[model samples]
Target chain A: MADHQQKSDKTVHRHEALQKKLALKEERKHHNVSFIMMILLTLVAFYAISSDKIGDSFAVMFILVLAVVQVFFQLYIWMHLSHKGHEFPIWGMASGILIAAITVASLMGMIWTS
Target chain B: MSTHASHKKRTGLMDWLTTVDHKKIGILYLLSGGFFFLIGGLEAILMRIQLIKPENDFVSAEMFNQLLTMHGTTMIFLAAMPIIFAFMNAIVPLQIGARDVAFPYVNAVGFWLFFFGGVLLNMSWFLGGAPDAGWTAYAPLSTVSAGHGVDFYVLGLQIAGAGTLAGGINFLVTIINMRAPGMTFMRMPLFTWASFVTSGLILFAFPALTVGFFLLMFERVFGAHFFNADMGGNVLIWEHIFWIFGHPEVYILILPAFGIISEIVSTFSKKRLFGYSAMVFATVLIGFLGFMVWVHHMFTVGLGAVANSIFAVATMAIAIPTGVKIFNWIFTMWGGQIRFTAPMLFAVGFIPTFVMGGVTGVMLSVPAADYQYHDSYFVVAHFHYVIVGGLVLGLFAGLYYWYPRMFNRVLNDTLGKWNFWLFFIGFHLTFFPQHWLGLMGMPRRVFTYMSGQQLDTSNFVSTIGALLMGAGTIVLFINIIISASKKNIASADPWDGRTLEWAMPVPTPEYNFAQTPLVRGLDALYVEKTAGNGKMTPAEPVGEIHMPNGSILPFIMSVGMFISGFGFIYANWYAAGGGLGIVLITMFLRSVIDDHGYHIHKEEVEADIKGGRA
Candidate 1:
């Protein structure tokens, strides 16, 4: 009877240890998610009041801002761009975006002027 | 490696016609794209002939406009982009050590969509007229364009655009999910980097085009006034949206060329790319900045000076990154054992020509200055300088570089030199005089000019140049056919290259690798070679390989849209309504269908590998 009681105590202790580890991970995740959401919400609120062209300008801005956040989310979570093992594609894709931006902006400027 | 039992499972033209192999799919892309390139070239030649002399009357004014429109659209969308994609599709998955692209069936579908769309667009010629709407198919004019011309533009691009978007998604997924063990992101080749970025641009940019095309359809066919000025609708909005898509469209076209150039330059020069990280950073910066500057295209349309000035500066900002890239290329060639192969010559030539293009681009960015340059031969000159000097040159360079790998035969150097010089001299001859004409106040798109307008001589020169360019293009075809027929197989490492692609065999196998390669570093093959390891270490054991089967469903899906296209154009209520119904039904069927695909048995695979039929 005493040995059986000892085994039960050990099992309980192991379960507690696992629970603590899981709790710590969840806490970190929550903190990060809230931080991102809060920043995004704050920006949207500020931009909503700041712009005169609220419907079009701020709306576009908001969409773009949202897209930026989404890209970050995609890179980190969906694309795993931040995954430790995936340096080449991450870097390559990033460069591609950079060059693409220049091409669009330059042409836009030229065409707008022309 | 030909000892495998399944090594000789099938061999025939039928097998190739029905094959779902990524390599084969890539070859199909090449053949189809090549065919279109020829057609576009012919269009270019016709355009040149029309402009040979002032009041030449070689072709009708209306015909000239359509020719110009189709020429631009076909070359950029159907010819260049798809041909580049052919290479990317053939090589990228292999470079990354994957068995196939993320979605093989979609890959096949994408190619077919392009093929059919190009055909559909061409069929407009037989129907009545071709799309006279400029490649951009700008709003007011496009909506007002009579006949079925605009209809072809809208429907053809939409169909093809869907295919292109699918291709982008597939590449993105493949790169994301399929890298082999130790093949980290930084280790991928610059070309793959380009494909990834190009795909991303396609993803975002195409949707804007989709929106634009639909609005155009509404106005032209359905009697909507989205772009009709009299109906409280703004035509400029269409311009905004079109350029929004259109401006980035150049990047979509050129950045991949830059990627190819980087690979070729480094390989032939026998050195690592100078400023590799910086080059990467610049590419990304360019892509990000692409969306910010579409307003520049609208300066002459009167967006006010403040908007114009900001756009000018934004436009100029692009040059800094471009200049950096140019410097990087120059330095890449510096202090290296540069082999002046046909590809290398093109790369070297690109530096000066592209830089000149860049300078002019910056000059055009100035709103006040563009007032002088806009709608003139100068504008044509600047764009031709960029597109021809930058993208087309890079493509030629890449073709020469990868020719051996693609066809297993080195393009004859003597013929290549002829091709390059004729193209080079002819290009300069054709465009140089245009700058002078623009300076002399010649407006573009004018079908004819009166004598003593002082434009005749330069125009004549321009026509002569165009003819030379045509002759050069013909020579390129000749070189391709002769070399292809010779069938001298490319070595595994044809250029003594740095990237992973050179590590693989010529005529790469269906499975890509019998086993996925375990990459240790950048230029992983080089590392293996130096280590006296003759073969790449396989990351995993050979086993049954899961692959998607070839299907007729994608073709059917496209045909549904192709048929519905007429409905939208004819504006027959039944056709539009029922035609759309067909599309909806196809989608529904596609979703409901269960496609588990197929798998090659391990025994067959082993036999193939042993026989080297893999």
Candidate 2:
């Protein structure tokens, strides 16, 4: 009878542990934070464009930097790319970016020279 | 599903239409690709006949243009790509020890789309006329060309390109996610490695073609002005986009051929591939560099000295990795117990032929020399040498090597040798003279030439060579028929195979592996053989096998797309609407349908094993 009671207790403990993992409340919190940050970044870009306080080139550069940051957040936080076991996909994406950069750069060169 | 019911359902023509088995789909690809290959070959022969004599009037100039265009389009898109897909489907899953591709439904969709798209493209010949502005289909000529020829090119390629893209994505995900336990990237067969890189190329390169075709479609069908220089659009844009896709496409075709040769050479030589890690690196490097060299094709377009120099340099840089591969193959054969099988013969022959093609390729890569070589028979000879000699030879070798795996029979060896020698000699005979012809000032894409222009003898020899090739193909067909009729069942490990694929039964089961294999090292099967165990160690106990159910939705979806393609070409809005409606409805049904699929019990698997042995 004592052994049966201990086994039942262990089962309950394992169930609670699984519940804790499945809740994912921490992940949800991080997602909310990232989402808000994205919106704020967008608003800042809008303000920089609308206000004349900054120079046009500075504003454009600022927005571009912000855009790059947003993309990181999107990939890492939203898409869970920061999580483990995504190395191959990350490699594929990086290669794609490299090729795209080359293509765009070449096209720009062609147009500029022409 | 009851075993008897499932068995009954799997036996008929209807099953083929609805089946989602990778092997079955592979057969479909082979059959369709073979059919189109014949059509393309016929076109080639007719062109040869026209050029057999100077000032020949066998075919008009207009018809000749159509034939050349169709020959290029059909062979590249319809024949070569699908045949590559055939081997990929038949082998990759088994090589990786996966039950099925990552997306079985999407795989079915891909095949059907390709089929319907090919049918739609060919339908142009019967309806009005085929596309005649060259398979390249440069902007102004394609845009201003009268009739619906270019329309078919635009729509057909659009649909087929979608299928190719889907297949590419499917392979990427499958390789990434579905490798067996202990099967690291380094442990993969060279064929799978090459395929992985090819898939990556397809993913990146095909989109350029898609965008180019979309622009053409809009110009031709919707009266858009994307390519209209008069409307302030650039004509060179089309050339840029086409080659961006076109250059990598050649790699996409050849890389898998390289993979096939690697497998065949290693198997026949009774040794592992030499410089295995370097081979992998070179394959990836080739794929990466493929994108940087598209401008080599456009050197004559006056991209200016700077652009031409950069592009030329980049193009020549590709030869490094390709040379690495070539040397690796030769080293693979060095000091090994070489069996000189039909497949090995092809592999050995491929080396010199591809090298010759590559030498010419580098010669043409020089921008100044390209000015002399552009739009000449030299360019034609160079490509045919690579395509026919490299890709086609590799394909035939792969067929001989894997025929026993695909079908439970061995192809007749003597006949196989005849097929090889005939095709090899014939291939050289047909194209070698063309190189001289190009230097002799005979232009390409022309229907006739004046008498006594010094082109007759070479052209005559080329025609005879083409006829010999035709005879060689006939011998292959007869060999296939005889092998099938004789029922010469092959052993499971025919050729003392090295890979995971040969571990399965002759007629591979639906689940492929009865239990998932535990891959211990490179050439997993060979490792076991050396260890005195001739079979793989199963990673899991025999259990119920879960399989995706076959569905006809993919076929219906393709038919619907075919109808919509016609609707677009003919400007029939209602037909378009109806076709799209059918597609959308089927998609909705598929979404709503909860097909958890069926399972094969462990008892059934046991029974199959026992019966096969019996």
- The best candidate by lDDT is 2
Error of 2 at B136 (Å): 0.8
Model 2 clash pairs are none
Fnat per model, in the order shown: 0.00, 0.55
Which is the leading candidate under DockQ?
A: 2
Q: lDDT tens string, model 1, B53-161?
A: 7778888989988898999899988998798788888778877888889988788778877877788788888888999977878778888888998898888888888
User: How many angstroms is residue A87 displaced in model 2 relative to the true structure, after the best TM-score fit?
Assistant: 1.3
For model 1, the superposed segments whose C-alpha errors exceed 4 Å read A1-17, A20-114, B1-19, B573-589, B612-614
Each candidate's root-mean-square deviation in Å?
6.3, 3.0
Best by TM-score: 2
Model 1 Cα shift for residue A75 (angstroms): 14
B444: Cα error in model 2, Å = 1.5
DockQ of candidate 2?
0.61
